[model samples]
Target: MTHNPCLSDMSKRVHRFPLFSITALLHINSTSALMLGRGLTQVTHIKLLLFFQTRHTG
Candidate 1:
């Protein structure tokens, strides 16, 4: 009819660990995706600038 306090605490920790890991993974994925998007935009801008410069020079 009773449970040990230490066991209860350990069970809570075991449950919380997976939730923290999942959120950490999601945060890392979103951060990387944002950086990738910025990189692509920068590459596209640079290419457009190069194309316009070459057209003007020619």
Candidate 2:
């Protein structure tokens, strides 16, 4: 299979600015969660926590 340089480069950028990416993702999820309902909001929070932990460890 041919390698995709563009995808690799994008991944590198994400790893470099994990915080900025996480904040943007959280903002998007928060708005959607508000429209979805309380249950989704809770799920979003848990996902956010897990994301944060993984970012730190991995």
Candidate 3:
């Protein structure tokens, strides 16, 4: 079987930065972090949402 661990980790990292930022801003942990099973765009989009809600909430 081909190993995709590296890719997975890379995905996590890429997902981590923005995700973490959004998480921090939104005050949410990784519980709501979207992975879409494994898609970069989805992950980024989710992170963006997290960021948006985080900053917009008065």
Best-fitting candidate, scored by lDDT: 1
TM-scores for the candidates:
0.70, 0.37, 0.34
**In candidate 2, which residue pairs get closer than 3 Å at backbone N, Cα or C atoms, i.e. clash?**
none
Query: Model 1, which residues run further than 4 Å from truth?
Result: 1-17
Candidate 1 is scored at a TM of 0.70
Q: Top TM-score: which candidate number?
A: 1
Better of 1 and 2 by TM-score: 1
Evaluate all candidate structures by whole-model CA lDDT and list the values in order. Answer: 0.95, 0.91, 0.75
Give a tens-digit lDDT track for model 1, residues 1-58: 8879999999998887888788899999999999999999999999999999999999
Candidates by lDDT, descending order: 1, 2, 3
lDDT of 2 by residue, 12-54 (tens): 9878986977999999999887778977888999999999999
